[model samples]
Target: MGGLLLVAITGIALVVGISVGIGDLPIPLATTFSAVTNRMGWTAIELNRIHETVIWDYRLSRALVAVFCGAGLALSGAILQSLLRNPLAEPYVLGISAGASTGTVAVVILGLGAGTISLSAGAFAGAFAAFCFVALLSNGARGGPDRTILAGVAASQLFNAATSYIVTTAGNAQQARDVMFWLLGSFGGVRWPEFALVSVVVGFGLIACLLHARMLDAFAFGDETAASLGINVGRAKLALFALTAMMTATIVSMVGTIGFVGLVVPHAARFLVGPLHVRLLPACAFTGAIFMVLADIASRALIPQQVLPIGVVTALVGVPFFCLILYRYQRVS
Candidate 1:
């Protein structure tokens, strides 16, 4: 397990550095290291000023945000799967992503809040609204996971219809184009602020989830079993659901919706580290960070002079894994 962790960490570090080094104006791997060391005051090495600025000001922050986003989403998925006892559940299963789209559309297409509300803020508000709606429909803390998921499905359909109506009737070509790009996900505009916010959310969220690892294990046997085992089923589900929502909302607001990391990484990590959340959670985090960074890298590098959506890259990888899981499921059935 320790060796596996070391490998995951090393893989993350390596890809992160590579992400920093590859771009329109490529920097050497050595220069990327030099920039890091120099900034950290570990070395007084002279470097090209342009390289230093790009490395520090833009790419590094984007990569770090991707790291946190990936970890947060993956951690959220693990929690959802455990709490709901549904292997197919993921971060966006609660309609958070659809709510975010509606929020972005309201801001960008419908011209709500004018200049007062940033896209991220609007999206967060919309996401929270969706969560509240779900809670209400499902009877909040008293609701079962199955009920909550059903509420989420209804919410998703509603928000998605709203978003479609607005886009078709209101937004112009340029506005629609912008919203479409954002919906598919990008790390292009994310910088230090995004990195800082996501790191704090995901970092503390991971710690909180880790503390509840045992309860999550109890949850796997269903709510009644969990209740019989002295776990506060309602409270635990509510707390874990909120945590998952917050993490997912933050990431979606910052980078749009990057799918499949949450869906794919937790399953892959579980395969490697087993179902014990104590070890599985950290494994998911590390694998997610690596997978997202590498996806970001692939997004940039896959097409010459043009970047593909990060979601596309992730889906390319995730779809096969998804199919394999389904195949195994059918075989078991």
Candidate 2:
């Protein structure tokens, strides 16, 4: 546990430093530290203002957003898999990201909540709406893991179609392009405010998951087993589902729909450690954070002149793993 924590902390710091150095302006490592410490009042080191702005204002925030989003999504995936007893389960599998994108697009195009509410709030509402709809749909006699997955698929399709329609009909060419970039995922314009919200939400979600780790483990065996252990199977499942949805919605609001971090990171963590949620949870968060920060850096560094959507980079990395998981599932079934 201590070793893993050390690695996670060091990995985040190292990636943030490397990402800060990789941008167009190219700040040095020492200047990066000096800028950070100077801001924190821990050092009086003098640094160039332009470099400081680039590091503090742009690169650092972007990296931190990636860290928070990655951590949240991956942790959400871990919880959902345990709750559903489905290894293929993920944050996107329940349509949370699709719903969030739809809500954000509505705010961006239809002028919904133009005066008061921010786009993130709208996105969270949209995600919550979708989650409730799924739960309701899956509440009948046919409700089970398979039924829930089908319900989620239906919800996802519905939300995705709505998002596409809004983007096409309501937005102009430039606006449409921007919306697509967001739907596909981009950390391009992340600032401190977005990072702060994401950090707080992800932190809260992680702590909650940690507190309920044992219940989650019981869930892996199904509702009956969990109930036998004095766990309120129904209530616990709903709580976890809501928490995961909130985490996903918060991240999707900030970084757009970053796919595959949730789907892939938990599996990788399981392979590294084991299936215990107590160990698996932190492992997933750390691995996901590292994966996302690296993916964000790759999104810029892969093309010398152009920045690719983060979704593309993660997809390129995750597709093979997705295929392998599918193959294994087929074999097992």
Candidate 3:
């Protein structure tokens, strides 16, 4: 019932988002849907070139990217929480976001925007490096969850310091502003080719993670119990770690460091559904998609003649909700 309700809410939210996109535009919802259907060859209806271009080229691409980014982050959070056995476990918890930001800043600061290798590539490299470092540290410690969490905290702080130094020393004002905005995150300025790349990476990663949901459920019981149940705990963890790193890197590369969707959405899903990975993972993905789409809408519509960063909107929404969840968890405990 809970899962069904979540799905229903997400569906409603998606519809609302589509309607919101039509705001202040000359396009009607029926016309928009007709344009989409005609494009997909479901019906033979003529669309004005302007309306078709607006719906197909700009609004649809942005909305879909928002959905993909939200779902990917939430799925990554679910996997991390299960693997670490920590409610607070998220991709950003281990300095991956900070590292990615630093690398992006490096690209902008050095004026390295030409060629196939851009700031996105640099961010991916940084995120992957940070993930590897944290994974090694987590594995080396016999102390388990606490040690892993501590290592992540330490890493996050170190990487943040590096990011700060780079921002302060940047020579050009435009470069500094660019780096700052990237760190804040946005879905604006994204093109179709970039969106397609992100979709492929996120889709593959989500499928891979869902395939191992059963192993994750076993791990939730405890490492010893998982081993007893014939699960190769170490191998499973390693594979998940790599998959998550790749996904996180891909997202951070494209969208910059949007935090809390991964951390907050998974916990919210777990609160509604139980700790069962099968139910929890899909619920988290759907809810996260809803959350981000709404956030993106709010970001665009909140101010007149100015667009806000999507990260700022998410942070505003996520921080209060996260605090509420923490309060409830403490009360229950």
Candidate 4:
């Protein structure tokens, strides 16, 4: 686990270096490192002001946003999988992403939130509403994991229909195009403020998950088994579920719906570090951060003069791995 963590750290540094040095106004790795260190007062290296702005103000902030959002999503997936005992469980499976999309589209298309609140605020509210809807349905079914999953699917379909209606009718062609782009995910305008918010939120999320790591381990078995082990099964499930929902909602609000990180990273981490949440959770965060940073870089560099959606890059990379996991699971079963 320690070795894996070290490797992950090294990989993150290398990726960040590459990301900082890529793009239209490319900078050297040495200049990128020196610019960063100069900001920290570690070294005084003369860099062009335009290069500094491009590297520090834009590219670096975008990279940080990817790191935080990726870590948050992966951590959320890990917790959900453990709590529900479902290998396929993910951060946005409960319609949180759909709800966020609906709210953002409403704000963007209908101008519902014209002045008072921002689109992200609307998204957070919508995501919470979706989670509450799922909770109500699951509770009526006696709060089992299977019931929760079914309720989530129902809620997702409902929210998705609402989103489609808003986009098709209320929005014009350009508005629809923008909404679709957002839904597919991009980090185009990410700056220090968004990065700071995500950093704090994802940091708290990681701490909360770490604090409850043992409860998650217990949850991996049946709820009865967890209860027999003196864990408050109901309370733990609710806490973990809410934690994941909040984390996922925050990320989707900031960056729209980037898929596959949440779905695929936890499984990959588990493969590396095993199922113990103590080691598994951090590993997921680290691996997911790296995956997302690389994906963001690919989104920029894949085609000349055209940027692809971050979600598209992730899905392209993740789909084959996802199929492999499913195939292996079936074979083992």
TM accuracy, model 1: 0.89
The model with the greater TM-score, 2 or 3, is 2
Model 2, span 1-333: residue lDDT tens: 798799789988888888888877887888887888898999999789899878877889998898989999999999988887777778687787889888888888989976577787788888888888777888832486667778888989999999999989999999998888888899988899999899899999999999999999998887788899999877887788788878888888777888778889999999999999899999998889889999999999999989999999999988788789878977887
lDDT of 1 at 178: 73
Clashing pairs in 3: none
Best by TM-score: 2
Give the per-residue lDDT digits (tens) of candidate 1, residues 99-199.
87678778877778978997767776777778778768978536765677788788888887888789878988886787678778899989998898889
Tens digits of lDDT, candidate 3, 69-138: 8888899889988877777678877677777776666666655555456766777777777776776777
| Segments in model 1 whose C-alpha atoms lie over 4 Å from true places | 1-5, 107-121, 128-157
TM-score of each: 0.89, 0.94, 0.86, 0.90
lDDT of 4 by residue, 35-128 (tens): 8899999999888999898998888898889999899989988987787676666756667778877777777677786768777677777777
User: Against the unseen true structure, what C-alpha lDDT does each candidate score?
Assistant: 0.83, 0.86, 0.76, 0.83
Candidate 2 colliding pairs: none
RMSD of each: 2.9, 1.9, 3.3, 2.5
Worst 10 residues of 3 by lDDT: 15-24
TM-score ranking, high to low? 2, 4, 1, 3
**Which stretches in model 3 have alpha-carbon errors above 4 Å?**
1-13, 16-26, 111-121, 133-147, 167-171, 328-333
TM-score winner, 3 or 4: 4
